[model samples]
Target: MRHRIKNSLALVGSIAVQTFRGDAPAGAAMPRFMERLKAIGRAQDVLTGDGEVSAQLRELVERALEPHRGGDCRRFRIEGPDLRLPEASATALAMALHELATNALKYGALSRDDGCVVVRWWVQADGSGGELRIEWREQGGPPVVSPARRGFGSGLVERALAAELHGRCVIAFEPAGVVCEIRAPLPRVAG
Candidate 1:
């Protein structure tokens, strides 16, 4: 428990340092940073709830996307079996989901009237808890083109989340839309 709190604080501190050191305009950076912090806080709420160090994967996804969803049920297709994630994996995955949903709203599926997103996950059981597989797919959006350089959100989702959860994240910008695939071991211990 002590280690979980320490590590979580360390990760949050790292995020704060990186956020302020970036080149974003002063007006834009603070709001974005606060949103990220809020996303983290939502994940922490699940992690610390009722003496359970694990959280429902579905609930985490919903909370992460809550700000961007705006009560539009038709734009999202979130489905998966009930699976519980360890604290570190839950936090990292939630942050990654929040970034993806924000980007989708601003520039991808959620930006268009005809577009939609689907989020699905499943678990593969193992002796060391299990392995989690999640997919985020966008459809009917504008033609996709890969960015010339990875941005902060990309770095956070692909690199930081991977390190924090000891996992792998791959994002593909297909002409049809954007797809993000995440796979991680379900370690009971906090990373």
Candidate 2:
């Protein structure tokens, strides 16, 4: 319990310290930050108490986006194989998704009524077990513009998630919307 509490505090503190507080008012940012914390909680909720085990990837993605659905479920489309991910990887991916979704709500697709996001994943046969690839693409939103500075959110989504999953993550800011692609080697001994 103590360890978990410490970790939870550290994670929260890290985000507060690392997040880029722009010219936006606290009122506008508070809800987004709260949503992010809720996403982290949902991610942790999926972890089995047992030693490093697995959980459904689809579930994690759904829960991360649940708070953003507002009234219409049609805003987000999630399509992926029924695969399980290790607890750590699952948590990392969930966090990344939360960040992506928060950004969308504030500046991208979810900001517009007609915009939507697609979450898709697939597995490729590698020499070993296989490789998992997850894609997050937004469409029909405001014109996408890359941030002038790479914020901590991008670092967490790209570098932190890649490290946790032992894979690569790339986020693209196209004119249409934002796209995030992540690829990682499937753990040899999956749960």
Candidate 3:
């Protein structure tokens, strides 16, 4: 019974991670799970410990996602309000940004002394909700080709994040370099 309970708890936690954030496997109902978790957490926090605990939970969630923040990204220039996001969503965003920066730092713009990167974002109203506009531009890098298949970096930039955030990720390869843009939703609670 003890082992069964532990296993059940573990499964619940896993489901929460998969639903509230894109911390689950591919081909799953990514956004549905995230929405479910967000709604459940909001309800849970309403009656139990609220403000402080919610903030702390958000931080803990972000920390848990640190490992996924991998890539060859370099310098970044981010602009806009730091809206409070759920720990899980925040973690996903951080992971996405970190991956971009890491990739730039390694094989992309930051690879050369003459090369550099710019990261920027902004918040805008969208109908009833809001949207976040983010851009990552790489300069002084070699030419690039849109891969026939999504590479690891592409998967994170295009698929994982876009699916979870309900946004669009566009990558443009110019003779000068690569420029990537993302437009994702910013929920009221997240801000």
Candidate 4:
């Protein structure tokens, strides 16, 4: 109980620190920061629940994208099997997904009325062990171009997948839209 409390406090402190460290005006930054904290809280809720040792992948994805769903949930298509992910991996993946959704809403498919996004995932067996591959594809948006430099969202997505879940993340800006793919070892990500 004490350990959990300590960890929770630490997480809150970290969020606060990150929130204030940004240069954006407080009026604009506060909302985005709060949204991110809420995302983390939802992931924590899933991780701490006693009903299951692992979290459902679909639930995590939904939670990550929920804030951005707006009134056009139909514009997003999410499909995957009932896969379970370990607490750490689930949290990391949730954060990554949030970044993707935020970017989409800001500049990609979700920004346009006719644009759409699709998220898909599957498990595959390799010589050593199985792997999970998640793909995020956006279409029907304005022409896409790679960013001149990586931003905080891109860095967070790449680093969290690599460091926290031992995964590889790739982001591509095709002329049509953007594509983000994440591949991670099943044993490590589904512990």
Candidate 5:
């Protein structure tokens, strides 16, 4: 049930981005896509849930779509040893992370001279497999509350990118800042 719900959310989020963001879809009707997104939104109140799972899922979506408020700084950094993984997955993750980081520089925590952003990643062996850990932190910004509505960006980061990598995201809205963390199994790389 939970997997299905999350998948549905991702689907809606993907189509919403395509429908609204000027990205062209091969054959789906735009109106139909919008309806699907609305239905998914109604089916789950992603914002109301609590606990680690809920918090992580919400954070995944939130970080994927960090919005830029006015006067955001434009500086940040990324840290992580390069892992051998599918190029597509790496690209997608990088793209999503870049979007959030860029937005933070423009409007979120990194927008001011006093603000900064830090992104870190690492690979840890777990049991029979390996897991990847990635974190994004916003150092300074105006006070922010969890938004009442989930926008296209959040939906994409949480649902789409996460599904692609078979991972979960965790976002936290803190009194002093914002933080996003993602954990996914490291995929095998073909020779």
Candidate 6:
């Protein structure tokens, strides 16, 4: 029980630190911070649910993006096999997905009525072991250009994937939109 409480507190602390690190106006930042906090809470609920040792990847993705799916749910597409992820990996990946969805809403494809986002994932056999690859692609929004400096979201995605899931994350700002790809060893992601 103590361990669970500690973990929950740590998660909240991390969220608070990350959410307030920006210089955005309070009105703008408050809603985003609340959304992110809710995302983390949902992921924690999944992790702590009884009788389920692992979480469904699809479910995690949906939970992460739930807050962003407004009247036009059709703007987002998620395609992936019914893979199971360990608790830690699920939490990390869920957070990363939340960040991506937030960015999409703020600056990428989801920002426009005509824009859309496609999220896909697959598992493949590698020389060492099986690997999982996930991609987030946006289209029909404003043209994307690489940022002059990495922001908190980019750094969080890269570091979390690398440290927690032993994955490599690449963020590409293409002419059309933003694309994020993550590749991780299956064993690590599956725990």
What is the TM-score of candidate 6? 0.88
TM-score of 5: 0.60
Query: Where does candidate 5 stray beyond 4 Å?
Result: 1-74
**Candidate 4 lDDT tens digits, 1-191:** 56545755665576566666767777877886787778778887776775654688888888788888897788889999888887667767787788788899899999998888999999888986888889999998889889899866787778757676687988888889999888888744334
lDDT winner = 2
What is the C-alpha lDDT profile of model 6 across 1-191, one tens digit per residue? 67656866787788778767778777777886787778778887776665564688888888787777896788889999988887777878888888888888899999999999999999988798789899999999998888899877888788866677787998889999999999988844334
Q: Is candidate 3 or candidate 4 better by lDDT?
A: 4
Residue 1, candidate 3: alpha-carbon lDDT:
41
lDDT of 3 by residue, 95-161 (tens): 4554565555556776666676666667777795778776778888766555566544456567766
Quote the positional error of residue 83 for candidate 3 in Å. 1.8
Residues 24-73 of candidate 1 have per-residue lDDT tens digits of: 77677788878888999999888777568888888888888877777787
User: What's the lDDT of the predicted structure labeled candidate 1?
Assistant: 0.84
Ranking by lDDT: 2, 1, 6, 4, 5, 3
Weakest ten-residue segment in model 4 by summed lDDT? 3-12
> Cα miss at 100, model 2 (Å)?
0.3
Overall lDDT per candidate, in order of appearance:
0.84, 0.85, 0.54, 0.80, 0.57, 0.81
What is the Å distance of residue 33 in model 3 from its true position? 25
Clashing pairs in 5: 59-171, 68-107, 69-107, 72-111, 73-105, 73-110, 73-111, 73-112
Which regions in candidate 4 have their CA more than 4 angstroms from the true location?
Answer: 1-19, 188-191
Is candidate 4 or 5 superior in lDDT?
4
Candidate 4 clashes between residue pairs 3 or more apart in a chain or in different chains:
none
Which structure is stronger by lDDT: 2 or 3?
2
Off by over 4 Å in 1: 124-130, 189-191
